[model samples]
Target chain A: AQSVAQPEDQVNVAEGNPLTVKCTYSVSGNPYLFWYVQYPNRGLQFLLKYITGDNLVKGSYGFEAEFNKSQTSFHLKKPSALVSDSALYFCAVRDRGWPSNTGKLIFGQGTTLQVKP
Target chain B: DAGVTQSPTHLIKTRGQQVTLRCSPKSGHDTVSWYQQALGQGPQFIFQYYEEEERQRGNFPDRFSGHQFPNYSSELNVNALLLGDSALYLCASSPPTGRDTQYFGPGTRLTVL
Candidate 1:
């Protein structure tokens, strides 16, 4: 079984300050981690993914995430927060090596980020 | 090119009524997936359609069904809807192969009265 956990229900940050949304996962095989953002009444937008290689992966809207294998964590990060960045964030994980199988993403509960000016 | 699109931005139905939601995959994309998102929760996968067939399904009940057309568009049909069925239904599109980054459409908000 594969699953993800985002401990925080909400995160508050001041504008221009660095922000982090924590995510942890449990999977049987190599983990393909992902971050997605969702605004009210809107669908989720892809932020970034960690498949292999570098621990740090940069994504759209000046957001990034660090994948720590030892910790089984993939925490989303931003150098500086923007009011526009305030939204709901989700962490998801999928197992690799099953190429013939359709990928099924297991998602966390979700974390709401509020960037205040 | 237009991104993934879903029809009927909002709909209200009574309990036991059936509803159908539509989705058009992004340009040049061949795969479509459906998800159900409850308030304040992450989107939960309903199923994935590829090559006009249901390739994968989640833990949802059989009352939740779907179809994929030859043109790569898809429809989600939920029969015998319950109050719990009210939520935002989202459609996602991704390439059949390679990176597997799924782009989402603005979801259809369903309200079951």
Candidate 2:
């Protein structure tokens, strides 16, 4: 079955410093990778996706992700972080193959991003 | 344009009771998908509705069912709810042209006591 792993439970970054939320995926065929953010008691907000094309995909709130096929990784990155960036981040994957590509997303447990000021 | 929206921001029920959650897709969207988010975990796909039909479903029990209206609104009905059913139910919608990117609603918090 297709799955996503977020390796970290939480990531702490100082304000103005860079931040990285790691994610890895496993799927047959190509992978449709996505990143979402959720504030307290809020729904998942779409950040960005890697369907195809360039290895680096840019997204909302000045965020971006790099899709590495060989490593099967699509890590969310931000050059400089702000305290407002604190929230729960999720990495989701969908296999482009049959039976697995029908709008069903396999998500990682999630990583809590705490941007300390 | 309005994003996806869900009704009854919060709900409390007991075991064996039934609950229905509603969702209004984003403007110009034609597909709606439901997901269950347990505390401290990622959201799990429950099912998806397109053209008022269940186009795809995840590994969930038959006790969970849904319906989609012509206006693109949807509802999730869970019967004989168990304590485990308590979760934050999320609704997502996607445009017909590019259903790849889905936008989610605020979600309804269901607590089974």
**What C-alpha RMSD separates each model from the true structure?**
1.3, 1.5
What is candidate 2's local distance difference test score?
0.92
Off by over 4 Å in 1: A95-101
Q: Any runs in candidate 2 off by more than 4 Å, and if so which?
A: A97-102
Count of backbone collisions in candidate 2: 0
lDDT of 1 by residue, A5-98 (tens): 9999999999999999999999987788999999887888999999889999999999999999999999999999999999999999864423
Tens-digit lDDT track for model 2 on B12-62?
999999999999999998888899999999999999888898988899999
**For all the predictions, what are the DockQ values?**
0.65, 0.63
Of the candidates shown, which would achieve the greatest DockQ relative to the real structure? 1
lDDT of 1 at A49: 94
Candidate 2 CAPRI-style tier: medium
TM-scores, all models, native as reference:
0.96, 0.97
How well does candidate 2 match the true structure in TM-score terms? 0.97
